[model samples]
Target: MARIKDVAAQAGVSVATVSRVLNDNPSVTEETRNRVHDAMAALNYRPNAVARSLRTEATRTLGLIIGDILNPFFSELARAVEDEAREAGYTVIMGNADERPDQQDHYVRTLMEQRVDGLLICPTAEVTPLVEEVSLGERPLVFLDRTLSGVEVPSVRADGSTAIAELVAHLRGLGHRRIAFVSGPSTLSTGRERTEAFLRAAAEHGLEVPEEYVRVGDFRAGSGRRITAELLDLAEPPQAIFLGDNLMTLGALDEVRERGLDIPGDVALASFDDVPWFNHINPRITAISQPTAELGRRAVRLILDALHGRPTDSVVLPATLVVRESCGETGPGKEDGS
Candidate 1:
């Protein structure tokens, strides 16, 4: 392999100049940059990431810990983060925590051991302390999706309450007095926030949100299907169900199909995070679309900013309600902008 010294000799420049050119340092003249590029092309030279990391004390790599890689929301977010990181000349290492504390802890430790330059984490409640310690360390850390309470790490998230409020209001507008809230495990921040928001919004709108009408699942499609089945078997079945996340939404759809229940006709549906298949499905799903791309891009920017010695802070991106056939045209809530 062509080494830096070889490139330097080929380009008739010092090793320092080669380094500057490779790093795209603004101080280097365009003519010098061209010469270095020409030499690199001629020699087929490739920078050694391991060597560069040793010299700079930075791996130029980021660790991404997601709640569930199977979920389209997380998958899309991961893709976005990876794309943005690549554009910024950084590599990404991903881990799926599956929303389990012990698993999450394991991944965090494993990533740290890899000596990643920074982290973009969607923390499980069990790994709160793990995140805190990492944030206090030298590594730049940014929280994505769910964040720990009282721990002031820079984060990017969707406004859960506002999205829930909109979902509830939309249902109410559709003449749904008894709306059920199907949620995931309550231990995570996202689940808790959505549950709290659902209850609060229903109460504010003079709707009775009975405990029996609320069901907590594992945020999986199967969980959604099982919980929806249980809800349907209840003494008082809900007219509509507001799902907390996309995976659960899929489960609910399967349940409806399996049980021969018609969406919007038998039970109206609205969910958070518009997954890619929403539009293509038989009965298109109505959803609060979190800015998935923006979330990933912002997380990358925040991590890079912190690495560059810039101040890091939390950022909550807005959500939008996408009207579709599942909720019908006159769906319950009035979207904030709509």
Candidate 2:
């Protein structure tokens, strides 16, 4: 098998210069880099990834732990993260927590055992003790989408307050008086922030959401369906329902369809996290459109910065309300300039 020595001899350069070219060190002149590449190709010299990692003490891999892979939003986020990681010359190993703390911790420990250079996580409901331990360790860590309080880890997320308010205003304008909410687990920062923002917005519009109208969900389709069914079965069912995320929105839509109810006529529907499928469905769903790709890219950047001993800061991108037929917003000027 061809080796680095063979490549160096063929290229008429020292092994160190070949190594620099292999490592993509910008210090190597373009001519030297081209010559080294030609030599490597001619000699069929393939660098051993394991040997390189052992020497550099870096695996060039990242661990991404998502809360739920079943959700389209999360799936899209994972794809974006992988794309960004790949662009930065890193590979990503992903773990799905399924919104469970134990599962999240298990993935964290397993990824650590695999010696991933850094970790990007969408935390589950409760802050696991394992997370704290990992944060204190030398390995770089960053939160994506969902964040833990007091963890001191940088994060990239969307600020949904304005979008929530816009949604509330849109619903109110559609003559919706009694509105219900299907909220995600309050233990997560995203769940808590979105839920609180909805309540605040509703209150500002002089609308009060009674206890019966507020249902807590697990950010899953089943919880959304169950909660939506409960809300619909109430003696005074709400005229509209706001879902916390896309998965629950699917659940709500399923339940609404099963009951032979027409959207925007029986119960108007809107949700956070706009997915591509939302547009293709009958009565296109209104949603809070987040910068999903940007969020993923920023999260990876933050982890890279941490790994390189550079300071990292949390990033909060803005979300905008996308008006559609589901929310009874067919009039002109209904959609935000998202």
Which candidate has the top score in TM-score? 2
- Taking the tens digit of each residue's C-alpha lDDT, what string does model 1 give over 93-144? 9999887878877777777777788888898876444454455555677889
lDDT of each: 0.81, 0.86
Angstrom error of the Cα, residue 317, model 2: value is 0.5
Clashes of each: 5, 0
In model 1, state the lDDT of residue 24. 60
- The collision pairs in model 1 are 169-333, 170-332, 170-333, 171-332, 174-332
- Candidate 2 lDDT over 1-338, as tens digits, reads 77666788999998668766766677999999999999989988776442233123579999999987888888889999999999999999999998888998888877877778998999876765567656655567899898888677788999999999988988998899999998888888888898899999999999989999988998888999999999999999999999999989999999999999999899999999998888888888998899998999999999999889998989999999899899785758774433
For model 2, the superposed segments whose C-alpha errors exceed 4 Å read 1-56, 335-338
Point to the candidate with the largest lDDT: 2
- Once fitted onto the true fold, the runs of candidate 1 whose alpha carbons sit more than 4 angstroms away are 1-56, 330-338
Q: Each model's TM-score, in the order given?
A: 0.79, 0.81
Error of 2 at 33 (Å): 47
Least well predicted 10-residue stretch by lDDT in candidate 1 = 47-56
